[model samples]
Target: MSRQVTPRAAPFRQFIVKVHGRCNLACRYCYLYEGPDHTWRTRPAAAGPKVLDQTATRIAEHAARHTLTDLSLVLHGGEPLLAGAARLAAFAERVRERVPRGCVVHTTVQTNATLLDDRRLAMLARHGVTVGVSLDGGRAAHNTLRVDHAGRPSWPAAVRGARLLAERYPDAYAGILTVVDPASDPVETYESLLTLRPPALDLLLPHGNWTAPPPGLPGRGTSYGDWLCTVFDRWWSAGRRETRIRLFEECLALLLGLPAATESLGTEPFTAVVVETDGSIEQVDSLKSAYEGAARTGLDIFRHSFDQALNHPGVAARQTGIAALSAQCQACPLVAVCGGGHYAHRYRAGHGFTNPSVYCTDLQRFIRHVASRLRESAALTSGGATR
Candidate 1:
């Protein structure tokens, strides 16, 4: 488990690169746009070609220094779709071309679904990219939070776009991602998404840290947990043969003596680093919610290369900082499974990311459920017995 060099993931095997800062829609819950910070107003609308070139070089350096191959580099944004075809395609090509010998690349985009079409799919597919469309759930559940500035529903437009991509380039489109409203009916949302039958689904909790609990109904702070359990019940009962939900799957894996794929949701450390449009680098973009400029780094992607940015004190601090947080988390019974929840879930202004999970009790309950199942499964494996 040495940090120097091991097949074990390096604190984080994936980097969520924020290539562009502009977005097509104005979802109320967006961590980047309206959730926490307003810094996007100052960032360049899109990443210029110079920023793109330096970014690739930096990622290549990090890969070589770390001796990592086959890493996950998620292209994120206010909406990465805003980056346009030419710039995005160039970014992809840079990674494909410059990453070091051991650094193999797999690319994916998290989009708002408005701009997804055959042309976009073709560009992504040409680079062997996978696409993840963000939809809040069914129309009612989705339209409530995801809307244009004029207060119009974006569900129809997004769904139409998704269907177009699905119909035209099914092979390149990966899945659907919905942000759980905590108030939306998990059963309804789950079934609706299941109907679409996207290859994968990601149900995300609203972005928040300890300083600010996620947006919740007036008195129902724990609704997020309740919602997840309902999904868990069906997600398991459905057998997960064709449809895969990352969060539930991670929870199930932890319950079954298996490891989780994502560090943010499980025992893995905060292995992700993000680069915003202005070239500044930082930890999780969700932190942008905790403070005005939570995700800022001194280096501009335009001026400095990715290597300098990656090793920059600010950049390295995010990773090094996790060690301190792990002490509190490592001892909790649920820690092994919840992994201290998300980085954003642990933040508070004065104390600053040094608090218990915002979903503390919520995660505790779910861990009990997962642990109970683990105990039962272990007993069966040992002697076909139930404890």
Candidate 2:
């Protein structure tokens, strides 16, 4: 099959660096460790200085080539904190030094929050590194799936870490990221996150594909959509917009004919790339959920430029908009808004990635719910204007 080429000129604006390839916790559903990908077994536990230097140089070259004024450098991991504070600080500094003087570099670290300490927090703060924590909800039960190696519950430590960040480093506390649990009460989950007073939050659907479909998805049901809609209604009715919910806001924005800023939805060219601990330049790490080595690009910062990775077949497929979607998706009215629901969630063994999301029904129901709410809001506004 001929590969589809994206019409728009896409450039690399985000780089997710896997500073550590080993995790302290053993989350039951982690797409990297617990999923199909076993490539992490061969990687160094932490990225060495040489890998960091080459990655920094490549990022600088990519920025200069694209004339990108702003770039987002995300410190990712099996657990980034496991790489130690000194390594992370040095890596961030090295990248910052290599970037062009005029380019703005926004650095962020996404952690499970178990290892956060006053000293580590201080170090990250000094470097202007924003921290994003992963917490399922406010209660222990909500986070039972996220446990340590011995299967001990990690909620207490995780919550403690989050509280410390919020109280001590409010400015540096970016927000929280929660993987959606359809079985959990959406309102309870949302309220629990409110306790941390996060500036923003993301509700991620469990990573799954057509072959190994996500849990709680029945053949004819839309439990995920129902769960999210309940949360949406509660958040919408609150009207204060107390905290920014990324998934809801992105969907609403797309519904309003605005450009989507997230890869979860819309046809926005995916500009994010991953640098594994072994210096492998790969597609988004999430692709590992699809199959073993699904993310590998046979490219590395040490030998290949970011521009070369951009032309990669996997990268090009994601940026190609409607051309990359399955036939059913192309004919659907919601195609522009849904954007086929994250590239990794459309995979199957025989068919490749040219398929609708495994969450198609849920997405359809959720989008329609949001659209209904939008129409109601518009009606109210029009009524007030005429009155």
Candidate 3:
């Protein structure tokens, strides 16, 4: 008998095109701006016509070659709205027009909500592009770090934008993306976000690695995990799904032996890649949090195919699944569910990305807690069936 082996490379399905290189607000903890990488400083402010055209062509070529049925076009940036809503819609149209006819393109813009106005939301909705907003949390106090160039708080404007999207353009309101802040009250943070009426939620851990540990990460404690578990309990005991909390739902799916993957977990191959503002093909942008030039692949749309990028060392490493993990990770009981953590979280100054995640203890704690809840649920169902 022969064992099945995972492929060396998987075709890219999510194309993150950086439309703008500079942000309207100067977020204090933004990994792209404040992290070790300063590559954005040298790039064009907004992706030029040449860059966008060539990128669309390259994406079409990749999709045709792979005969892909679905692909995601993520119009990203330091703040994509700085490029103007019309320009973003036009760029999305270009990709949609260029892709193979059979390929369904799902276009989205990940923006900080301060720039979202009625006109922008209407234009995005008409163009079939959804909007995903980013925030630290729901309140002004939670977003003290998210301020404008002049140091004015963006919370008031953000609130207006979020409400407008939810009220007038609900279909285009994809979700709210908030980074986990262990310092805040987890349940309070979770409930406040619900008031915005987002269809879903994207909860991301702060991007950090061993050398540059995330803020508030205790030396030997699972504070981040504890925060997540509190939120999980709140969400679970609600007796009805309030909205899609991506991290929690994905973890449950993985625990149930269902096929699921996210940037944070599971053994599924990473199939997303980034196209920088200047047309440079790179690994996931989060790698910028690890080191200077950490995301670079030396490939560009004008000269290289997405297939060519599949051969890059960083991209290949992510697709290798469990084989890419450190020996300790391979030996761990929860390897399948945690997937050795996010690739960027495994970085150390000299050792590269072979180590387990910086949040190893936190992930272990969260996974076990979820597993216990699952068992309790199963027991309840069994008892009811017996009765």
The sequence of per-residue lDDT tens digits that candidate 1 reaches over residues 88-130 is 7668878878877756788888887877777877888888788
- Tens-digit lDDT track of model 3 for 189-269: 998899999889998889999999998653778999999999998989985379898898899999999999798999898
Q: Which of the two, 1 or 3, has more TM-score?
A: 3
Relative to the true structure, candidate 2 reaches a TM of: 0.97
Question: For residue 51, what is the lDDT in candidate 3?
Answer: 94
Reference-based lDDT, residue 168, model 1: 77
TM-score of each: 0.86, 0.97, 0.97
- Please write out the lDDT profile of model 2 over residues 1-387, one tens digit for every residue: 112323465988999999998989998888889889899999898888899999999999888877788999999998899988778888888888888889999999999999998999999999888899998897888998999999999998999999999999999999999988888989999998899999999999989998888996537999999999999999999893789999999999999999987878898889999999989999998898989999999988888888888889898888888988999999999998999998999999999899999999999999999999999999999999999
Q: Indicate the worst ten consecutive residues by lDDT in candidate 2.
A: 1-10
RMSD of 3: 3.2
> Would you list the clashing residue pairs of candidate 2?
none
Off by over 4 Å in 1: 1-12, 217-221, 261-263, 302-323, 326-330, 374-387
lDDT of each: 0.70, 0.90, 0.91
